[model samples]
Target: MRTCMTVRHGAERRTLMMTGAKLVLMRHGQSLGNEANLFTGWNDLDLSANGHEEARRAGRLMRHHGFLFDAAHSSMLKRTIHTLHHCLDELDQSWLPEYRSWRLNERHYGALQGLNKDDTIARYGREQVQQWRRSFDVTPPAVKPDSPHHPGNDPRYASIPRCDLPCAESLAMTMKRVLPYWQDMLLPALRQGQSLLVITHGTVMRALIGHLDGLSPEETQTLEIPTGTPLVYEIDKAGAVHRIGYLLPPT
Candidate 1:
C-alpha cells in the first residue's frame, strides 16, 4: 500500500499520497546518431527502427510495473520528443501534459556535431576525443557563428537570445544550463507531489543525474546512462532525492 505524508511547497502545504514523489529519468531511444556512432548533439535526428522498439519496450516495462506520471518532458530535439510520444502512447496516457525545451537538448558538440566517432578519434587522437566526450570541463571545439551546425542557424532557436545559444558545451557547461530547468520547472512540479517522466539525450541525462545525485566531478564524468532505459529516483519526506534503480534491465 502507498503511504501518505504532508509536504510543504513554500507557504502552501499539500498531502502527497504515495510512498514518496517519484521521477523517471530516461535517455531517448537510439537516434540516427547512435546508430551511426556520430556526435549528434542538437542535430535533431530521428529515431532508428531499433530506437522505436526500445522506447516501446520501456513503456511496456513501466506499464507492467504500474508506473504512472502526471506530466512528461523532453528536449526540443525530435528523437527525444518522438521517443516520449511512443512511450506515452504505450502507457495509454497520450493526453498527458508534455513540455519541451531547448535547455534539455543534448550537450552541443560544436564542430564535431555530424562527424563519425571513430573518424573523429582517428583525426584528433583518442585521448583528445575522449577528453572532449568525457571530461567535465573540457569543451569541444566551438562551431563558427555561420556554421550550419551552430544552433544560432536553426529557426527554432531564433527567439532565444544569441548569447544563450551554445557553440560548444563541456559537461560542466551543460550542467550549468540544465540546473536552472530543474530549479524552475521540475522541482516545482515535484514539490507539488507530481510524478514526472523526463526523456532526454545521453549527455544531458548524465549532467542531470550528476547534479541530482551530488556526485563528484570525476564520478559524474564517468557516469553513463543507457539509451531508452528508465532510471528512477524518489524524493523522501524531507525532500531529499534518492536513486531507486532502473525499471528494466538495460538492453
Candidate 2:
C-alpha cells in the first residue's frame, strides 16, 4: 500500500500525478543523539556520519523518482537544514528557491533534550515517558530561553514570530505554527502549480501527516515515519486529495 493508492471514499481511479504541484515530506537524517536514543527535540545538533549518508541516499531517491519541487521549506535546526542541503545536492537543484521556518522543527522534548530515553523511561516510568514522547499537548519541562540548549537566540529563530519562539513545543503546537505557513506560503504554491518539498523533524512530520490524513491526535503518535524517509502527498485540482502516503523501497 505504500506504493499504490487505496481508495478512501470513492472509486477515485488512481494514477501517478505527473504535472500537478505536490507536497513531498522528508525527515532529517539520523543524528548522534538518534543512535544513542537521546531526546533531541529542538537541541539543534548536526548529522552524524551515517546521517550524512542517509541524506545523500534521499537525494538519490529523489533523482530516481524524477522529482522536482518548485520551492522548499525546512526547519531552522541544523539537522533539518543540512538534510535539505544534502538532499538538494543530490537533487542537483541547489538553485531552487526555498523557505525556512521553525514550524517544521522536531517536537520539543523540553528538559529532556539531552537525556537518554532509557533513563527517562526508567525514572519517570515507561507510560509517562511514552506520554511525553507521543502526547499531542503535554510538553515536558524545557531548557529556559537563557539556557545553553535554548533554540530561541539562534539566528534561525529570527524567522519565527517572537511570540512563538523561546518556548518548547509539543506536536500540537508544531501544527499551530506549520499550518499557518502551509496555508499562507505553501498552499499558494500548490495552487499555482508548483510542487513543494518539506524538510523537517520527526514529530512535526507526524503532525502534518496527521492533519493531511485526518488522524486523531493519539493516532498520529501511533503512526511511524522512518528516519530520513520521504512521504509524498499528491493533491489534485478541485481541492481533492487524490493520493497521500509514503513510498517504501524494495527489501
Candidate 3:
C-alpha cells in the first residue's frame, strides 16, 4: 500500500503519492583522498581498492532490490566515473546513456583541497573548519590561481566559461549549480517516467537531497551520507517526492 503525503516547499504546498518512477542518488565510493581524510574537492583521484569493492556491493544491493535505471548522471571526476562504471557493469546496464557535468562535482574546498582534515583543525579551530565544511553559506578561502587544485587550471573544466568557474563554494553555492541541472535535465526525465541514477560526491548529494527533501539549512548541515550507498526516491505524477529510503536494508 502507498501512503499519500503533503510536503511544504517554501511558498508551495505539494501532495505526494507513490509512483513507479524512481530517482536513485549514490555518493561515489571512497577515493584515495577519502582514505587519507583529505579535502579532495575538485582534485581528481581514482577509487581505492575498498572503494571498488564498495561500488560492487552497491550495485549488488540495487540489483537485489530489482532497481533498473534508464539513464545515469555523474560528475567528471574519476572517482564518480569509475564508481558509475562498476555499478552499471554489475547491473548489466553498462550501455545506458550517461550525462556528465561539472555541476555535479564535489563542493570546491578551495585552498583547503589536498590538506588533511586533522591538520586543518589543528591550524584553524574546529569550529572554523566546520563552518567552512558543513555551513550552508560560509565559503572557505579561495584557491589562488596558481594553486594546482584551482579549477581554472583543470582541462576537464576548460570548456566552462571562466566567469562561471568557482574558486571556493559553500554548500549553498553548490546547490545553485546542482539545482539547475536537476530542473533542466533530471526533473523533466522523471516527469516523463524515467528511472534515473546519479553518482556524485558526498557534499553534492547532501545539497541535492536537501533540496528534494525540503530540509532546512541547519538540518541539511547535519545530514550524513555514506559512500556507495544508494538513496532511493520515489516520485509521483505531479513530480513531488513521495517516498525516500535506502535501496539496501540498514546493516
Off by over 4 Å in 2: 1-17, 158-161, 249-251
Q: Please list the C-alpha lDDT of all candidates, in the order they appear.
A: 0.86, 0.75, 0.86
Cα lDDT of model 2 overall?
0.75
- Candidate 1 lDDT (Cα, 0 to 1): 0.86
lDDT of 2 by residue, 1-251 (tens): 11232211223333343456677888899988898899988787899999999988988877776777778889878888899999999999899897887667777677788999999899999999887778888778767877767766677566656666646666787778678877788777777777788988778777777887888988887877777877777765554554455544433
- Please give the lDDT score at residue 184 for candidate 1: 95
Which pairs, if any, clash in model 2? 110-142, 111-141, 111-142
**Residue by residue across 123-148, what tens digits does model 1's lDDT show?**
99999999999999999999999999
Query: Could you tell me how far off, in angstroms, the CA of residue 233 lies in candidate 3 after the best superposition?
Result: 0.5
**Position 56, candidate 3: lDDT:** 90
Alpha-carbon TM-score of each model against the true structure: 0.91, 0.87, 0.91
What is the per-residue lDDT of model 3 for residues 1-251, given as tens digits with 9 covering 90 to 100? 24243433334455455446888899999899999999999999999999999999888777755677889999999999999999998888999999999999999999999999999999999999999999999999999988778888888889999789899999999989889999999888987888999999998898888899889999888888889988778776678875456554323
Which TM-score value belongs to model 1? 0.91
